[model samples]
Target: MSSETTYAVEFAKTSRAKCKKCSDIIEIGDIKILTTTTGGRFDVTQSFHPKCYTLPRKFAGTVDDFVDETLRDTTEGQILPKERDALVEAIKTSSSATKKSNKAPGSASSADAIIEKIKAMVDDGENEPQTKKAKRDDHYSSNEFVAAYRVYQKEKNDELKDVLKWNRQFVSGTKNYLLVKVLDGHVNGRLARCQLCQGGRLKIDEKNCSIVLCNGQFDEDAQQRIPCTFQCSIEDAPRWKPWFTEEPSEEEKEKMDKLEADATGEGAGDSHGDLASMKKEAASLEWNLSNKEGIRSATEDAIGLLKKYNAKLPEDATKAKQKIGPVILAHKRETPEDIIAALWKEVGKQLSNEEKEQKDKALEKTTKVDANAKLVAAFQELSEYYSKEANQRAVFTYSKCLNAIRGLDYEITAENAMSLSKGKTKVEGIGTAFAQKIKEFCETGTMQKLEEKRADHA
Candidate 1:
């Protein structure tokens, strides 16, 4: 056989090969291209979906020249006329996109010049509306409050106590209570510190409507402590910065307003309003119970509320269904609270088992060094590159493949790399495209894809 490189196009015989560009699996019978490069005693072949195939820049020839070369004296597979045309069009489109991407910003191209003219016309306010910029605030919405509460719930009891102490809030409560208190303080704008006096701070007074400082001096005449008037919002405090950076959407704002109104008994006079409030509260508790760390406390709170309003619960509300793991835990003959309790138990078991498995896998990874460390690093680099490009699918595929490679106990050599994807000991996430990449790295000491990525970034 001639010691030359060749390319051939054919339909995929199996659904094992992944597209090089997209990192997605090509279905069986899809048009694919195989490039074979012969060097010394070993021949390496890489497969790609036809649309993903890019002509080598080193090949100084036209599309027809490359096609002629591909068609010359090859009997293994033949490219159909229509497929050949598609291949040519794909190459041209890929090349055009590559060139456009490679061009720097503000480059003096005809396309850029036209874009500049359009941008200039828009900048001159020809037909654009003069809308005022919306003012931004640091108010936490319902979703943000829930998310922040989950994070706070994950902290240790001692740490949560410290946080409450720092904020001068109530330090005596269960972990869930502390979590909810801290989050509510920020969300409701009730947590504040007096800028006038060092000893001045306020606590939530559930019974009274007056604002009295916790450490303020009591007056015998007024029969009340002096109120602090220089209070400042602690929402932008550094202590809460990590948890509450997300801004709420307009929908979240409306939901939060309604929830606050319900909490304050704004429209609880009618039975309909009372029932609606209970359902909303139950839904909020359900969301909180979704977090594994808050399961116990949230479940207790949920059970208490259910007991209080169980008789008022509608039939459909009591019969609401929840999916936990693979099993659907429904309220066939039980109350809504019973279904919730069952969900909590099932989810706790599943979470415990998952945590154990994760710990075991982490231990395994630490004990055994990756035998294909270089290849794993290359794939990791590609994953990061795809992530920077906002190619989420490609990033996920490469990340999964690299993680699988990290778990390999044996080295990937040129001899065994090809069989590693097909043999009984096949890696879980390695598709044909990644297996070929492994073989290429083992033989050439570098991946062409990685090199191209480096070149592009450079």
Candidate 2:
């Protein structure tokens, strides 16, 4: 046997390609794993689908170690249980065969010797071990609001134990203000709606110790005495700073103290407290909203509205339908009039467009076009604009979305867009956040952030 061994592993998000291992088609937008092996006089590059990738003999560790080290950069299509099992079995089979072959050469090699031989074959000067970094779950950098909200939700559901995951979630000194966070899910770059009065968008006061505030009518003086619904930011939140571990400055401490004081102070009186109590109890009270009869009636109403406006019920609306009960309960409404009123309001918002536009070049850029086309164009635009090393993550995400949409075999209408936008969609590479953008594109015919990007790039 030669003293050389293979030393490289790589992966990429790319267009359709055939898998070298199985001769099966790796569809467009799929993640492809590739490996490079170079011996004394031979070098080969092998490509495989994630599931098809085998444990390489030239690598330095076990199958699990290989996955952690080589595939750390991959964002989609992680190895599953079946694949891991298959890879492990295949590795054992190969090892047995290699020993048998070596036995004929009057050679006996220990496992450690073989491992050392393989490790030494890599050209260390060319391939440096990549330092592992924490994955950025908050793509839009909502100041960890997305992650914090997830923690808050899990706590609300009585999840057995809280698991601190994201680095941002470890942000110190967050004053958890009890603002009803509207637009609670992904809709990144879009402001959270103030659930109290819908007066203004919710914002994180990064400068004020992670307090939440209603941009519409927040008064800092009234924060402690009344339910001013002000948002706050977490002071000394973890970031890529030179001295991030340093404690908060005296001025920062003052801000945190003020924000904490506001969160516990009694404002908005008993009514506010009652509403908070109701919200806490909203999930537990079984006021009969998920019943078949109730669902049937609501479905009928929804279908009628769809028909009246020549619209169709989105597949994603199932969750929204389930939420109908909670929505009514959250508002503390028990009467039929109150429930029906709430239902109609939501229906009307979805069905009607409150904006009008005239024909013009600028209008064309901002006007609603086919949802699919808009999404593809928006992603492409983003990719081109963020074509730098620092922006690779953003570019990769946008490109993945564009490819996913292009691979869609059916028409991308508003209904389909709405359905795809739901967090539950099973599309590869596209998650809840991307889906929210797709939904926004379909609903508004244009995304405000994408257009802003266009202007900036132009």
Candidate 3:
């Protein structure tokens, strides 16, 4: 065996890589053979499915010698003796078939003959009657259909039109009309009627792929439609239960009633414009300039109304009070009109500030998530590597650190890495070793330990 070429047997961690021999996907958690060929500076690695793997013709060794030489030290006791024996048998069978095929060109080998026999058996089974299998639609319940309908209703008008066009239905209609047409096609189509009617007065129109009532009645009529009395033979429930719409819950009904009341202005006393009314009243007040007492009384009334308006808006109330306080104290120097104008200006400024703050917070949160995503991915790779090596303690430690990083509320940047990892408010589960790795990643965008692991595996 050459020292430049080495192999290891392990289960694949992902389904993204293809098998070198068969050119098929090596599915996740399936046994695979990893082949590493050392070059000048880098190592190239290839993976192959267990059954597709073949021993090198140059290697003159027994099956046990090959297995012992290929497997890594960390995976020595992990693979069972029976699994090794199975692998050895598979390699021998593959080698024997190759030699037989080479000796007799254009002739079927033993493996090929066995495969043909299996295929013929499958063909014979296909010629016989098969038990009917349930459909994907039949598995869904009435609530599930209602949920899907709700999602359909929430789609954009263009999306709804596309769905209708794909289903070969009329697409020129309002959103609600399109939705109803699609729903009708699914619920009242030929298959639904055939399943529910059970050979009743309904005839299938093969050309149109539709079902029509034999009594010349339309399916739109409540009584003429498939009767609700039809029972399902499989579950002893209504055969068309999945087509039925679910009724609104109490909370949904209450929300609908509240919307109706607001639209009609019924039992909704001044809740809509109370603040505007108060502001208008304060602005419209007439104070006699000659009478100081009357001006004082008018000022007090205006202030009271402004306070009432502030009370109605809890989110802006505190800021509004701060703005109104100065105006209230300066009532003796400023006129009522000036006082009211100043208070409104302050309210506008506060609202603008709040909006800006909200936008900044949203941007910050987005940046934090992007940064954390990279860190989490790196940690996950390390965790997976440790898991494959059967280092349970390292896997657990890395998993805990990854979770702590994900739970962080702020982004860990190069400038804040030290504070987050070693300062007073250091993150939990991140010890000295993990913190060093995190700091290195934040500064260099890669961890040395992770790179070394990849190089070794390669």
Cand. 3 Cα-lDDT:
0.52
Tens digit of lDDT per residue, candidate 3, span 183-253? 44345431222212122322222222112222121233123322211111222211222221334456755
On the 0 to 100 scale, the lDDT of residue 57 in model 3 is 80
Q: Is candidate 1 or candidate 2 better by lDDT?
A: 1
Those runs of model 3 whose alpha carbons end farther than 4 Å from true positions after fitting are 1-7, 10-140, 143-271, 286-303, 310-458
**lDDT tens digits, residue span 169-288, model 1:** 667655544555565554554343322222234443322212222333333433544432221122322121222223455775465445433322232222234344445555554433
What shift in Å separates residue 34 of candidate 3 from its native position after superposition? 3.8
Clash count of each predicted structure: 0, 14, 0
- What TM-score quantifies how close candidate 3 is to the native fold? 0.25
TM-score of each: 0.26, 0.21, 0.25
RMSD of each: 25.7, 21.7, 22.4
Per-model lDDT? 0.51, 0.42, 0.52
User: Which sections of candidate 2 miss by over 4 Å?
Assistant: 1-374, 388-390, 421-424
Winner of 1 and 2 under TM-score: 1
